[model samples]
Every structure is written in C-alpha cells, then in structure tokens.
Target: MSDTHAIAFVRNEMLPQAEPPVTQRGLVKWLRENMFSTIPNTIMTLLSLYVIYVLLASVVPWLFNGVWSGDSIRDCRAALDGATGGCFAVIRERWPQLLFGSYPSNLLIRPTMAFFLLLLAAAPVLFSELPRRLLWFTALYPFLAYWLIWGGSIWVPLFTIATILLSWLVFRALESRSFFGAIVAALIVFVVVSIVLGGPVVALLDSIATIRLQPVESRSIGGFLLNFILGTTCLSLSLPLGIALALGRKSDLPFIKGLCVIIIEFVRGVPLITLLFVASVMLGFFLPGGVDFDLIIRVIIMITLFASAYIAEAIRGGLAALPKGQYEAADALGLDYWQAMRLIILPQALKISIPSIVNIALGLFKDTTLVSIISMADILGMTRQRIMNTSEWFGVYWELLGFAALLFFIVCYSISQYSQYLERKLATDHR
Candidate 1:
C-alpha cells in the first residue's frame, strides 16, 4: 500500500506539445490583440482596411499600366487608349535634367564622383564603429567636393584648406596661453589669409603650376544636384555653428551671450523665405563693387544661418535637460569648462539632442525646395523650368512632382531610420 501510494504520481514519458489556440497564437493572435482587441479597435481597423483597399484599387492599376515610353503626354494618353494609366514618360524623358539640371553632359562625371565620394566621407561620421582615421577623408571632402562640382583651379580649394590649417595652427599655438585670445587670433589670421589667398596667391599659384577642371558657373548647378548640395552643405555647417551658439548663449561674458541671443532670436523671428529673398536680392547691395558673390553661396549662407538658429535652440534644450549634478561632478573632477563640456556634458547632451537635430536636418533638406521661389533651379525648379514649361510636357505635373517627392522621401526616410537605429544603439536607460 505504501509503495503503490509513492509511485502513483510518476509518469514513464513526457507529454506531447500541443499547438496554441488559433485566436491566441501567431498571426491570428496578433490580429486579435492589435487589430480587434476591442469593439472600437475592430471598427477602426475595418474602416482603415476599406480606405486602403479603395486607394490601392485605383492606384495599383494606374501605376502598373503607366506609359513609360512616349514623346509627350499626348503620346502617353494615346498609348493608354482610354484606359486609366499614369503618364510617367515625362519622368523618363526629363530624368537627366531632373537629376543634374543644366549641368554639362560631359561634366556629369564630376558631380557623379563627388556624389559617391560623399557617401565614403559620410560613412565614418555616421557609423562610429568605422575606423576613426576615415575622418581625415571626411574633413577633406568639402574642399575636394567643391573643386569637383564647381570645376575650377584646384588651388582654390587647396588655398582654402591652407587657410583653415594656418588658422588652426595659430589657435593651437596660442590656446594654452589664452583661450579667448587664441580664438580672436585664429579668426583674424583666417580672414587675412583668406583675402590674400583668394586674390594674388591663387593667381600666382595658377601661373606657377595649374590643376584645373573646366569651370562651371554656380548658375549652371540645378536639379536634384543643387538640392543635395544645399542640403548637405547647410546641414553640415549648421550643427557645429549651432553648438557654438548654444555655448555662447550660456557664456559668462555679457557681450558673447548678448550677441548669441541676438543672432538666435533674429534668425528665428524672420521667415526663411524672407531670408532667401535677402540672399537673392539684398545681399548684392551689401557687397563691395565688382565683388561677385555667387547666388548659390549666398543662399547657402542664408540657409545655414537660418538652420543654425533652430538647431541652437534644440541643443540648448538638450543642455538644459542635464542635471546640476553633472556640472558639479565635472568641477569635482578638476575639469575646466570646455574640457568638462567636451568630455562629459556635451556627449550626453548630443545623444539627447539627436532626435531634435535629425528633425532640423530633415526640415533643412526639404526647405531646399524653397529655393525655387528665388529662381534657383533645384529639382523642383528644374521640373518647372525644364519640363513643365515645355509645350510637350505641359500639365504633366503629377509625374514630375511625384518623382521629386519619391526622391525626397527616400532620402528623408533613410535619415529617419538611421536616427532611430542610432538611438537604439546609444540607449543607456535599459542598462
């Protein structure tokens, strides 16, 4: 009786695994919980499905049956023969102008090289896991890119690089003695050297030895190339400038703080379109006689300044979010202000500010479209001037605009996805 009682609960083999119920597992479970968890949710889900279906029903056939080969909208319509289809031939015919604008066909290789090289330069900066040495290329890329796209005497960018290096050297020599003095000296050296190099020095260098590309005017730069140039240039410039402005706004020096405040406030108060107008029309008046400032350069400057103001506020918000103890900890470690900021405060603040900064970048990139108002030929501008203005492609707005929209969406969506990935990679809250 005792042996029998002890052995009663024992089993010789394990039980077989059973599948979960249809409504409680896999796709069925997911649909039940997320799409039909409650009556309201079910109703909303069904309504959304219906709307999506209605849209796809029309869109799918139209997109799939689009006439891609045609000389004009009429040709496209004729090909469609009363069937519903998109006249996408406009995009096919105007593809080059849409991408490179009025850029010379033979010189296309220049921008193409710059474009691919840009990816190489950006890779290390975007992904920190890459070798830090790649930053050398990143630093040099701007000047190289300028030479490539604008197609000029290589000495122009070379001298420009020299100016920067000269200024940096001066700053380094004076930095330990007096930080403020170092900055002033560096700035003065930069300006003076820039003036000398821009004129006689460049000319003299050209006489001695020449490395030249077929010169292309800034005016010739249009299409998506122009948009990329503006967006990348402004985005790259605004971040560091904004960081400096954010720091200046918090400085103990009243003059520095006041100046920073004025710049940030003034730029923020003005509409960007107004700023663009100033760049296009008013900027010429400010320059000395016979000093031709390229319109693209002026627009870039204006756009960069506008973006910097917003970015400064975003960075400032990030800085403000840090605890007082972080500052105290820096002080306790015997770190000076800049040291503390660079080593500790800024890193964390930048991580926090990533989302805001990415938003600013996206906004600045899209705002390149606004250059069309000033008669600059960005992608949108090319569409208007080169395609739609022509009799053949007149009223083919949807296809051209849709192509531009698709290009922007691809770039912006990639940026957003990268930012999300970065946030996940840098996340410390879980630890």
Candidate 2:
C-alpha cells in the first residue's frame, strides 16, 4: 500500500468509535431510573404497586370468570364457582324499565329515540377534529331530543330547536358580523317558507300524535339513567355554585366573605346524607303548599349545596396557589373584583384545581345513591327494590353492588382521565 494511503487509514483508525447508548437492563435499572428517581416517587411507586395487586386480586376473577353470563339469578350464582361474580341478568331484564321508567309502554319509542340522539350528540364532542358545523347539529339536537323523551310534540321540538339555534346564531354573531347578517336573513326566510310550505300542518300532526301517545311521569324514571341524571345535575349545579361561594369567601368585603365562610363551614361540618335528609323532609314544609317540586330537583339542590362547600375549599386553595403578579396585573388594568377574578386569577386557579375538583365531583356522583334513603328511585334504589322481593340474596347483592361499582368506576375513571388531559391542555400558554 502507498505510504499516504496507509497514513490516512491509520489516522481514521486512531479516532475512537462512539460507544453505544446504555441498555435499559433489569429491575435495578428500572428502580433507579423510575421508582427512586426521587424520594416521593419511590414511595408512590410502592404504594401504586400495593394498590394494583389488591385490585387485581379482587377484580380479575370477577371480570373474567364472572359477571358476563346467565338468565336466572340461580344460574349466575352457579357460574361464579366458589367466588361471586356480578349478576348481570337483573340489569339485562330490567334494562328498558331502567331507561324509560314509567314512560308509557307505547311511548317507549320516544325515549329510545332520545337515547340514540344522545349518542349522536356525544360523538362529535369526543372527536377533536370535528367540524364547527357539527356543534350546530348539536345545538339543534337538545330541542329534538327533549321533545321525544319528554311528553310533547312539535311545540317542544320547535321551541327547543329555536332556543338552540338562537344561542348558536348569537354566539356566531358575536364572532362575525357577516354571519350575524346571514343568520338574520336565513331565519326570516325560514319563517316565511315554513308558513308557505304548510309547516304548521305537520307540526300539528306531530303534536297530536304525541298527545295520543300519553305521558310518562317524571317520578317513574330510575335505574342507571336516573343515576346519570342525578350525578350530572348535582355535579353541574354544585360546581358553579361552589365557584361563586369560593369567590365570595375570597372577596375583600367582610360581609360577603363572612357569609360565604359560614355557609361553607356549616355545610362541610355536616354529613351529606343529613343535608339530604333536611332537603327531602324540611324543605317542602317551608315552601307554600300549592307549589309542589319534584323530589329529583330537591335532592339535586341539597347535593349542589353540599358539594359547593367542598368545592369552595378546593378552589380557595387553587386561588391561593396563584402568583401575586397575576392579581396586580389584573388590578392595574382597572378591572373590578369580578373582572379580575374571571379574566386573570380564575383561569389560572381553575387549572390548578382540576384534580381536586374531579375528586369532589366523583364523591358527589357516588353520594347521589344516598338519595335512595329519601325514596328517590336512582339506580341503587331500583336495584334494592328488585332484590327485596327476590329469593336470591347472594346473587342479587353481588350483582347490584358489582354493577354499581363498575358504573362508578367507569365514571370516576373517565373524569380523572379527562381532568388529567385538561390539566395538561390548560397548562399550555397557547394564548
């Protein structure tokens, strides 16, 4: 070989080979890298493992070998071998009653339609890439769904659709002047065209048909659907009320703060069930005799009040976590107390509060079953109602409790997961 070539080859050989990246090896590598990355992390890892093992031990068999089979309660018990699985048959047989409640047998079609419509509405919300127009579909949705589910006709549909459409148009108008003009023109044309096309004739027929279909009383609705409503209504009503209370507590005015403090502490001090007891028992007597309210609505009010207290405490912690700079900036902009909180402090505070608020919401959702004590026919209440007349205690208990647990688990898990996503999303400084 030539001396120049040899020298070049030697120079290349003299340069060191880059070492390969470190292999992630065994348990120690995992432990060092993950479990004990920090002292707190190590403790959490250990705790998580313990919880996972405990859950697996209780859940695996019930999930795989149990819960899925059979018609009679006896068959379900037999399927569990020595261990008990969930009794799914009770849920299966009573599914319709659970869904529609005392919705007249002939009126089942309406609720079933409403159920399908709900799925339709939810589909777009879950998909991030869904078109804005899909929301317009949703806005017009509640009106149609309510009319079908509730005892009504075209009047309800027309009323609901108009409300939703108006809301959407208003929102759109706020966003764009062109859209505002277009919507106004379109609405006028729609009214004129409907009148010319004999739209009222169809509306009359639809209303007459529904009236002939009879009506289901609100009291009859129970089971899983009722639980959903109870949880949703309570959580929805409570959190907003709680936000107001938290803000009130933090207000500069002594009277507002003191009143908020008193309400929150008093509610927090009592068991939720006791509050519910007062709501169901005493609230009615306080009201004038002629004005009757639904039991569901009253229970909802109690739950909202109870949850608001806890929520206020959670939000207060969040508000406290914010930097002083945010407040100063908000105030310097000449914002009022409400404006400062709404525009500057609350957005940040609410982000910090996602996890705790989720926890409270979960607790409230689960606590809704206690309404059974007040003879409110939520899911647990109906399940108990079914079992009281049955010969099968073991099968029924395992079934109902397991079913309820699964439902609760799904809801809480969903909320926790969504809150985690929200926490991450809100933490971003996209604005």
What's the TM-score of every candidate structure?
0.95, 0.69
**Candidate 1, 207-304: lDDT as tens digits:** 99988999998888899999999999999999999999999999999999999999999999999999999999999999999886889989999999
- Per-residue lDDT, model 2, residue 53, is 97
Clash number for candidate 1:
0
lDDT of 1 at 37: 93
Q: Rate the local accuracy (lDDT) of all candidates.
A: 0.93, 0.73
Lowest lDDT 10-mer window, candidate 1? Answer: 1-10
| Candidate 1, superposed: residue stretches over 4 Å from native | 1-14, 428-431
The C-alpha RMSD in Å for every predicted model, in order, reads 2.2, 8.5
- Identify the leading candidate in terms of lDDT: 1
**lDDT of residue 354 for candidate 1:** 89
Q: Per-residue lDDT of 321-341 in model 2, one digit per residue for the tens?
A: 888888899989998766687
